[model samples]
Target: MGKKFFVAGTDTEIGKTTIACGLLEKANQLRLRTLALKPVAAGAERTAEGARNDDALALMQSASIELSYEQVNPVLFAPPIAPHIAAQQAGKRLTVSQLAGYCRGTLMTPSDFALVEGAGGWRVPLSGRETLAGLAVELQLPVILVIGMKLGCLNHALLTAEAIRRDGLPLVGWVANRVDPDMSCFDENVETLKQFLPAPCLGVVPHLPGASPAALAEHLDISPLGY
Candidate 1:
């Protein structure tokens, strides 16, 4: 069986997709087949193909094993809002079982790697009673956290790591994405995380003018991830 990983983030807009695609690029470098799944997505735009998400599109480009947009992002919400709120506005119901089942089937595909990304954060709501984290637990996939390095990153990263551990999910590794290029003492903050978080720092990505998966791939070191 191939390896499956859950790409989670400390908070929204924290370079989760950037890190996920970089991992896909690394798998491609090893000539391994990869499938990237964004099971549920919000903030979609109408396109020639239909409503699509930029993050899902980027992931599709990075994936080695091609699949339709629908296959990659099964549930899409038009409003640029929280998933549960969007679902409620659209009169659609989401459940942990549904997403878990989709992930299970995707894992059965013949691929060297499968990376699934969550919408916002680990505990974002999929429904009134169920959270996206519940689906990750159901899938039992080890997590790769994307930490957006900035002023409050130390607290955010540590808290996110603690929550993942409390949920009994293995924090396989983490990526340090420099969102704020001007943030002072950047290297020191990274060193502090290394001292605290148990997982290895897979990579420390710096700010780029126009970053693509292939471009960011050069900055990432996936050796510690064992993929």
Candidate 2:
């Protein structure tokens, strides 16, 4: 079995996919086979193949082990909205068990590294009672948090880390992605996170526009992830 991690973010548009792909690229640099899965994604466009999401596509491109689009992202919603709402709009039900089943095959594939990226944040809803966190819990995978560095990141990162621990999952590592270029005291904020979050700091990615996973990979250190 590969080293698999459930990647979560502080919030939406917080570079979760960016950090995940970067990690995959880093693994590839070390000649390590890699796989990535985005089991549930909202916001997709119709494609020749089927409903496709940009984030999932990026992950597919980054992984050394190839998988079909459906394999990488089994659940896709057309509207760019919360997944639970999108499921309701399409008359479909989103459940943690169903999503976990979608991911099991790829997770079991032979590889040195694998990642299962979640939609939105850790507490994203799948149904009235089930949150996306339950899927990670079901898999019993350790977590890698992506913090979008900016104002209020301290609170967001701490609360997210707390929730992951509260769910009885280990927070293996975290990445600090500089989403806010102009945020004051950025170094101090990162220092605060290192002080508070109960995990090793994997990387600190500066804000780079239109950067590819290969470029972002230079900013990350996958050593702490046991690569």
For this target, which candidate reaches the highest lDDT against the unseen true structure? 2
**Taking the tens digit of each residue's C-alpha lDDT, what string does model 2 give over 169-218?**
99999999999999999999999899998899999999986798899999
Off by over 4 Å in 1: none
Model 1 lDDT, full chain set: 0.90
* lDDT (tens digit, per residue) of candidate 1 on 43-82: 8888988999988998999999988887899889988799
> What are the per-model C-alpha RMSD values against the true structure?
1.0, 0.7
At residue 56, what lDDT does model 1 achieve?
94
Local lDDT at 9 for model 2:
98
Clash totals in order = 0, 0
Write down the lDDT that model 2 would get. 0.93
